[model samples]
Target: MRLTRYLLALFLGLGLCAGPGLADTPGVGLKPDLRLLVDISGSMKTSDPDNLREPAIELIVRLLPEGSKAGIWVFGEDVRELVPHGVVDSAWRERAREAVPQIDNSGQRTNIPAAITAATYDLERLDPGYRTSIVLLTDGKVDVAESPMVNASSARRLLSATAPNLGATGIAVHTIALSNEADWPFLRALARSTSGIAEKAESPQALSSIFVQALEMVAPTARVPLSDSGFAIDDSVSEFTLLVFFGGARNRLELVDPDGARYSANSSDVDWYQNQQFALVTVASPSAGNWRVKAPDSASLRVNVISDLKLDVDPLPNSLPAGRQTELGLRLTEQGQVLTDAEVLAAFDLSVVITGPGGKQLSIPVSREYALPADGEYRIVIPPFDAPGRYQVVAQLQAQSLQRELPMYVEVVAPPEQPTLVTRGQEPPEDDFQAPLLWLGGVLALLLLAIWLHLRRRKRRKLEIWEKRARQLASNDSEPLEGVSADQ
Candidate 1:
């Protein structure tokens, strides 16, 4: 029985070691990992006439945010890594672009199975701290060999199985069909299985645009503000969240949206992480107004919320377009709703602060206010952002003791690049999706080690018991029968 328990414990230890656990705690400050897989089969020669593939690749390589990691793969009968996975920088960008033209169309067939497998392998090699994805751009179907593993059905099945496993590891597979001839159904199904999008592009222009969009989606940017009392949510803002970190003692929090809707910390929408002293609230379709937050005064940590506030001074051509006038827009709301008409807005005083890319600061003239189609929406005009870079705009509103400020960050690229339209404002932190997996892995490893040691000690104790029993029997046999003593 003792031996049976020892064996059982040993098997349990092995079982634990076999399980690769998941991390539950979120990880912070990790960059995204994107791997691009482009089909280089002969069909591409007809489908991609303008040769926009290389240009799209180059553009994506150029625009990827710094610190993010990306790799490029060209797939034919076999897969080739045009650019090895590495952190994005000026040097890396140059190397990635240089390799784009090197992609040749010598292979006659497309082996999507091999390509996907290779990309998955590369992504798996990433430091599990990243939000990883594979952006697959293909213009044709899976035309590889007809084998159990290489046939179309087999390929789909392999991907079908791999997709969920990748998702389990926090990796997604986004598919972009560059032409109508591509296997849209299969691609879409593959992407859906992995919790990714399948985008279709029929023309070179559309494909180029999709490439930029894909890269942007793969590598998102984020900003956190340090403030107290209230933070701004843009008029154009949609859904947003507030993460409040408390310390020392529990803190009470209250949230007021633009439409005057009030929510408390114990509201149904609020999620609390008691162990971490963090509470998060997600607001859907947030009103375009300054959301007020009342946090505990004793909460010493910085408490800033990323809310929806759209206040911008944008040049028609965000590239500034030389002498064009810049359009300034602001949306006002009270409590948590949009304010329309002078009756609802009679109690408010509003002003805007404009800071140019050149560090120049000015205030928009109150007389310059013009009405828009929506209630509480206001617009004005400003001089073009002649010099290139980022500009900061802030709009302020005060109603009695309640004060709100909305901050908008705009980018003005140099001439030649088309104007960039930013529909989304500041992004939330890109927390690690793999953190839970990592934490689980660590705990499982430790548990397995402990179980192994315990089982080994139990086995040693069992062996010691058997040895003692054998010695006792041997001594009795040497002492002769009970009736016959040492004299006999």
Candidate 2:
């Protein structure tokens, strides 16, 4: 996630560079470029005693110079760059104007880390002359994590990771606390950390002037601090994770504009960065322009940005049985710093079906997006398959066609029983309970036939008896007729 943010910010910093706005910073000629990081977190919509958000927005719009360049970022549970930095043209202003009509401040997550990461990563690609920064105005404290409230400790950790080492980068952070009950310590530390002034909106009236003053802060000496959240060296293999701590509460955060305009971090714009944080990111070797400890604070922590040895998966096993999952051992010197997203492939023969645990076979699943745990060793679970034979396991860099395979003994383990049954002391007997019914039906049919035959025989005998009786009567009549001649 941090890496993605880095790319996004990097694009702005490297691509669409804009010019300066406020020439107020007298002789420096550094007309600061301002990107408003608005705190659209719902509380902003409250029409309070004097509708705080309306006043805040009005104050910001009024202070901008005619050609002031600004970007819009609305941060809440989910932070988004509403507008990216570019020259302040009527088109840009129109976008902002349209934004005001549709934008309502309400989100569940106050993604301070997302905002800061995007801003800082983008800042690095801008010109050294233009002053660029975020003007953050927030009424709440950093609520991060899966919790409803901003996760205090996690928010602090995140902030520490991305907190700009502006003194290291020659930029400054100006912070304004708009709420009465914000984590003063966090805000104060952010300003102090970046060697900028931190102020409070004691009253709505003072909010505007405080913002203007905050903006006027000049750029520090020009220096490029390391950009990767931390350093990633290949001391260990398999996978690695590097932790970066930037204490927003105690450092200056310099912002570089997309269009080369530099601006100080101060104003009514909460999106400008009310604070800073640290993050974990991957990096290539040489570790140029990195940073080390300069100050400490409540949000302060140490980090190791170096390439440690990684658990090498040399001659990595490439193939296994179709229905079995393979386990591999990994070792690491840096322990947590390696690639989890490395693309691993397994190849199978045509006759040997290698369906995955999900039934699909012949797939390249492992890639560079997987988050590598601190342990360099990972148990690569290969889904089971029906085919029983040797298969090849290939470890390749994600997106790179390169691949390494390991041919091994393939044993097709029987698939686990479906509708499996288990009891305390015995195996379930296999019974064909439906078989007896067929024999029972045949016997019933035979018995019915025998009864029908017996009835038929009895009826035939009765008919014969009737015939005999009739004959006897006729004979008797005839004999009698001897006495009475023609009567028969």
Candidate 3:
């Protein structure tokens, strides 16, 4: 019955149908439809004391591409939509950034089910060309009530019914669990069942990095590598955004362009947002040459760009059956055309680094020799994945003047084991088989009946203990807790 309730809720909330013209390809060039669900329950006051979630979310909002769709929701005893769902344009991004400050840890309970329902409500109405994903950040269990059993039952319904339905409809639910007390098992299961990534943050400071990783999973961006706080802006790069991380002092970040002209937040062509922890800056039509950031030696920077030159990896399936080998295709393209110059391809070293379920690393080199067709695409055969868990694959390309990395996540699932059959040289006589089967059936019936009675008695004893405790509290003029049904 609980599963039925979950299904009904999901049906009404999500529309329970694949959108018309949904992309048949799993992980190609589809645009992203991202929903961010943040938990603002009381426990977050400890887990994220400084409220770094605000800046972390702002980082995501600023980095989103112009055409994608996104929305933000904060959850506690109930769910509230902080940002309305719409196409990601300049105005939408500004509104989302403004809404980030409203997230706070002041709620009485963590109602994850309600949050999911609200975040995904009417998601089927979106354009079928986009890939739907939900990034759920939480710091506690499903605490809709005082009883742990009730919370556990709610979790079960969510995993058993809702998660599968979401996966079936091509929606990924990426989960982030904060603090040691967070419900890791439930969060991990929810992500695994929906073909999403599961991440844990031991400290609030880690939320920003984890948010960046989650963004990579949902909507990866083309990045221009930053080395020693310096990077080159090629002619193909139309726009570039710099994410600089720093600590200690509150100082303005400055950039030195190709002509050695220094620029800061006050510069004409730069858009900058700064907080205590980090600063995000976007520069349009940057000059083509070497550029450097003026920051402390200990500071770090990441440059993401919108460019004509890009590293393209073949789309990876959301999941793969265990012990199956697959081929991965990689290529370099400039302005939508594959690069076929031998000298250009020979300048870079390309490799694939795979992290398996047990944290083992496997590095496979992508041969410089192009395939028979002479196309720029490089192909590598991924070895059979023997373990049943999530695998992270990163394709890295490094050359004298450029660096690029593409990260992809895939889940490997083991098929159910078949029962082994034992056979004898001779079959038993029909009469003997009939008699033994009847006797065995009687014994099994008796065993099942005994098990039922023992369970009933044990449940009754537990109920009596709870009832006694409740009555004692009531006698002391304390608030009485709600009763839990045995069926739960």
lDDT per model vs. reference: 0.62, 0.45, 0.80
Candidate 2 clash figure, as a count: 81
Model 2 spans with C-alpha error above 4 angstroms? 1-28, 45-50, 66-68, 101-103, 147-150, 218-488
- TM-score of decoy 2: 0.36
- How many backbone clashes does every candidate have? 25, 81, 0
lDDT of 2 by residue, 277-382 (tens): 3322222232222233223343323222222222233221222224555553322222222322111111111111233334445653342323343332344545
lDDT digits (tens) for residues 1-488 of candidate 3: 32224323543455432321111333445678899999999989999989999989988998888889999999899889999988999899879878889999988899999999997798567567788899999988888888989988998999999999999888989899988898898898898788787789877777887888788778767677676788887665679998877754555589999999998877766888887778888989888778999886666678888866577776466567788899888776654456554545565688888999799999987744434225566778889899988888888876645566778778787876999887866676779788888999999999999999999999999999999999897779655467866666
* TM-scores vs. true structure, each candidate: 0.42, 0.36, 0.70
**Which 10 consecutive residues of model 1 have the lowest summed lDDT?**
310-319
Prediction RMSDs, each to the true structure: 31.7, 23.0, 23.6
RMSD from true fold, candidate 3? 23.6
Sliding window of 10 residues with minimal summed lDDT for model 2: 342-351
Q: How big is the positional error of residue 434 in model 3, measured in Å on the Cα after superposition?
A: 38
Which has the higher lDDT value, candidate number 2 or candidate number 3? 3
Off by over 4 Å in 1: 1-26, 122-125, 146-150, 222-488
Model 1 agreement with the true structure over 176-285: per-residue lDDT tens digits: 89888998988877776675667788675556556654654555322223356665554333455565544445667778876787887566764332222434465756
